[model samples]
Target: MCVEEQWLTPQGIVIGTLLGIVLHVRFSPDDQQVAVCAGNKIYMLSAKNEAILAELDGHLAPVTAAEFCTWEKSMLISVSEDRTFKARKL
Candidate 1:
């Protein structure tokens, strides 16, 4: 994976469980934050340590996509199978 080659070293590997099916992943404009859409939730993670920074629980069904705003680093947009979308400011 690109994340393994670029972010992880020879001894590092991604391992764990998320909320559910991971539909999309996106990075902030500054590349300091990561947004992951899994199931019906959006998980905000730190790029440095890959730690959970926040969990956005707004969608009712599975999330389809997620992205961060280029001009505003605090803005996050998401679409879900619940037939709705949300734009939140972090």
Candidate 2:
């Protein structure tokens, strides 16, 4: 994905990939990082280069949704079909 500023110059900011089936993705309020969920795991990546910063795994079933906490930039919430919700700090 590329991050671009809406201005006269339409230069794109190229970012790498997480290399998997991405189920969901959300960006933090600061816009410096992003949370990605794939299969049963969640990963935090740099929004600038898409580098993997952290990986979290706990759910037994496939993940359904992933969201970032507005109040906490380092906190992420995820829900799975295993009938469980997880709160993790990235």
Candidate 3:
């Protein structure tokens, strides 16, 4: 979902548990979703309920960072210890 500008204050924070080491967590541009970088995969999670939406697995090594593109609300980028940068649209 592409949101032009986010003006509303988030109602609450999302809290949950995840397996393995979590490298990074990035909120979607619209603040309705979350992308978690853990180990070799990116976990797409729901911001409202903290539920696992999907798992993005492509890197062969541990992921170092993940973020949502500010300009492209549906785009996500992840970097890995294997020296590769991946971009995906959610």
Candidate 4:
């Protein structure tokens, strides 16, 4: 979704809550990125800046879990309330 928005704390630390009500979060295999599941979509974010990089929309219900593929950092696996599981390429 490319939120391009940042949330700053009083101490000047930035925490990204852009995805809104994130149900799950997992680091990439290399720990260089993060995958977040919010609503029915999955958001790919930069680990360093928490910048949204891509949005994947395929689930019909709220996503319940998300994890990066162990062998492929660009591949993400997700489960949803829709009773389905899916994989997306980042």
Candidate 5:
């Protein structure tokens, strides 16, 4: 899901939301990227432009949490409502 989207100020026009209810969104350890867990998928986005760079889909159910490895920045870890865990190497 390469959402080529934009974000506005609090008083500006509202933009569309991501694919589904966002469970989690956070910056990477190096502060160069973003990870989002939503609707059984994990989205890796560019921190500078808020563009989706990658979409990870493996869980059978909605993903609950996603986080970047503090030590290894290339890895993205997530847990799903399906009772599973995954580690994606970026």
Candidate 6:
């Protein structure tokens, strides 16, 4: 599950997972957002406040790796066991 606690205290707001177990996570250059690769889908979330922003769906198998592009601030690259590599715009 990708649930995130809102506060430091034990009693805090929690956000639930979107899909399968997260295998890898990468943060954008600005650090305002993060990308998570779980199962066969990739999810973008707010780094300041862990909230889902967008979902990327295409990979047929579990996503293995994910990284933010240095040259392109708006692009994210991911590789999967499906023998495929994809570049998506953030």
Consecutive 10-residue window with the lowest summed lDDT within model 2: 1-10
How far residue 21's Cα lies from its native spot in candidate 2, in Å, is 1.4
What is each predicted model's overall lDDT from 0 to 1?
0.82, 0.79, 0.84, 0.80, 0.78, 0.82
TM-score to native of every candidate shown: 0.78, 0.75, 0.78, 0.78, 0.77, 0.77
Residues 1-90, model 1: lDDT tens digits: 687686555455342244577888887888887888888888888877747899899899999998887687788989999999999999
| Model 4 TM-score (2 dp) | 0.78
| Best candidate according to lDDT | 3
Number of clashes in every candidate structure? 0, 0, 0, 0, 0, 0
Model 4 error, position 11 (Å):
7.4
Question: What are the C-alpha RMSDs, in order, of all predicted structures?
Answer: 5.0, 5.9, 9.5, 7.4, 7.6, 5.8
Residue-level lDDT tens digits of model 4 in 1-90: 233433232335243665689888887888777788889988887878858888889899999999778787678889999999998777
Candidate 1 residue 90 C-alpha distance from true site, Å: 0.4
lDDT of 4: 0.80
Candidate 5 — what's its lDDT? 0.78
Report the C-alpha lDDT of model 2 over 8-85, residue by residue, as the tens digit. Answer: 453576443544787788878888887777888877788988488887899997777888887887788999889999
Regions more than 4 Å wrong, model 6:
1-18
Off by over 4 Å in 4: 1-15
Off by over 4 Å in 1: 1-19
Candidate 2, superposed: residue stretches over 4 Å from native = 1-18
- After the best TM-score superposition of candidate 4, give how far the Cα of residue 49 lies from its true spot, in angstroms: 0.7
Model 6: weakest 10-residue lDDT segment is 7-16
Compared with the true structure, model 3 gives a TM-score of: 0.78
Misplaced by over 4 Å in model 5 are 1-16
Give the per-residue lDDT of model 6 (tens digit) for 2-89.
3565443454433335557989888788988878888998888887665889989899999999988899989899999999999988
